[model samples]
Target: MKTITFNQKETSPIALEFDELIPDEIFTWEKSDFDSYMVPIGNSKFPLSNYFDVEVEGTAESPAEVVMIINGDLGRVKYIGAKMSNGQIVANSSVDLHCGAEMSGGSLLVNGDAESYAGREMTGGELTIKGNVKEFCGASYIGDWRGMTGGIITIEGNAGKQLGECLTGGEIRVKGNCDILAGIHMTKGLIQIDGDVTRWPGGQMQNGDIVINGKLSRSLEGFDYQEVITDPTISGKSFSGKYIKYLGDIARNGKGNLWLNAEKNRYLL
Candidate 1:
């Protein structure tokens, strides 16, 4: 893949917005083009070169043939790959909010933690985070009824609240622990939590599947207990442990499925 690299030289006190610097828009750009480009900061715009040194190598005819790498601290950069439809992005350090929101294709790999609204409203593609993510990861934008209509998000570390709130489609896998209200109000999709969950997952969910493989600290009263199954298959993925399944966020007349590791959540039995 052709590569475009950005090495940070300075950080602005005001966060920089990266919505205009995505691979989809810059695959054909030369170093000169980037040198002349401006990035939005708060209500003003400044030349992007003020913060990073740009390097471009090789050539590409399409966004899919390119790779963008951001090296150094990007903790003040937002919308790292928002609305991108193709290509790949690798952020080597912690990133600010909306890192991969509204993406429709390609892949995003974050070597460090991401702030809230990561992957919000994404319709396609894959987002992988190596560290913890804050609230609203893979969730709908506020005031929007639909969230994450398609794609896959894999978080190697813990996730904050509302991991997939109001989701309509796609898959989210949290390899580590997650906070409360994951998959809440979801209508379709799959959420797998490999580590412990705090409380109240799948609350008010109308339809969808949530598999919690670790200890559940508490269970909500909205779900009705269902029979336990050995090595249950959820969303085409087979899990080896005995699982306790429940249905409903009955308070909302929902029919979502919540599966918990039977051994870890025996208190709910």
Candidate 2:
């Protein structure tokens, strides 16, 4: 596989956008090509050569044949690899907003954390974050109803608010805690949270499933609770514990189900 590396020379507290540096692009680019590249920073684009030295080795016949590696603290760099259709990208540090937005194929791995919109509107591929992620990790853009058309996002650490807001397809697995309004307004998809949740999940959801394996802080009044079911079948998979099913988001006339582990959440009883 072809490799491209980005090593930061200076930290920009203002944040730089690296959406143009994905493997789907720059696969055929040479060292001088990247040197002549201008990356978006704030409202303007500056020479990427000024921030990080460039190195390109091997060759890629297509976008799917390339791999990009970015190393350093990218907390101030946004859109690391947005709208990529193929190939692979690996970031050694935390990245900023839109890290993998609209990705259609290949894989993106972030060794550390990521900012919001990590996999927004993604049609395919896999996005893995080793650490925690912030709000709107896999959500739709503001005023849009379709979020994450396809793909898979695995978060090893905690997640912020609206973990998969307005989700339409795809799957999101969170291994740690989550904040408020997870899967809000989701029309279709699957969201599995293995840790604690703050409140108001699956709010106004029309369709889709949210499986909570941990304690829930509160339940919405709009949801009507059903009987406790043991080892219930959800999304073609069977869970080992008791679960409470709530159908709601009635304000939108939704019939979606919110499955919360009964044994883990005694406070709602």
Candidate 3:
């Protein structure tokens, strides 16, 4: 695999956008070409040579053959690898917003936290975040009906509000807690939360699956209480506990499934 490394020389005084430097566009560029490049910071473009040292090694016939490594504090850098079709990207630090928006293929791994709109409108591939993420993780843009169409996002830590909103396809597995309205308006897909939920999950979902294994602070009145079942199979995975099934977002005539843990949330029984 071809590798491109970015080592920070100085942290950006203004936030930089690294969306344009993905494997799809820079696969053919050499180290010298990278040295002369300028990355967009806020509203202006600054010479990338001023912030990080660049090194591009090996050769690739396609973006899928390339591997991009960003090794520095990227908490102020937004859009690290947005809309990439094929490649392997690894960010060793926290990243700003839109980390993997509208992506079609390949894989992206953020070793730290990510801001809002991570994995928005993604059609295929994988995005893994090792730390907590802010709002709108795997959500669609405002007024849009479809969010991620394909792909898988696994957040190893807590996630903010509106996770996987308006989702069409794909899967999101959050190992930690999540804020409100998770999987809202989802048309298709699967969301698994291993931790507690704040409130109103699957608020208006038309069709999809949301499995909450932990406590739920509140549930929407739009859902009708279905019978509790044991060893429920959600999205092809058998969970070894009793679950309360709910149907409707009756407000939208939605038939999506919201499975809440009966053991953890016994008050609702």
Most lDDT-accurate candidate: 1
Candidate 2: minimum summed lDDT over ten consecutive residues — where? 17-26
* Strongest candidate by TM-score: 1
Each candidate's lDDT (Cα)? 0.94, 0.88, 0.91
Clash pairs for candidate 1 = none
Record all residue pairs in model 3 with backbone atoms less than 3 Å apart, i.e. clashing.
none
- CA displacement after TM-score superposition, residue 53 of candidate 1 (Å): 0.7
Ranking by lDDT: 1, 3, 2
lDDT of 2 by residue, 148-185 (tens): 97899999999999988889889899999999999998
- For model 3, give the RMSD to the true fold: 1.2
Comparing 1 and 3 by lDDT, which wins? Answer: 1
User: Over the stretch 1-269, how does candidate 1's per-residue lDDT look in tens digits?
Assistant: 68999999999888999998888999989999999998999999999999999999999999999999999898999999999999999999999999999999999999999999999999999999999999999999979989999999999999999999999999999999999999988999999999999999998899989999999988789999989999888888889979999998899899899999989888878
Candidate 1: list runs displaced more than 4 Å.
Answer: none
How does candidate 1 score on lDDT? 0.94
Candidate 3, poorest ten consecutive residues by summed lDDT? 9-18
Clashing residue pairs in candidate 2, if any?
none
Better of 2 and 3 by lDDT: 3
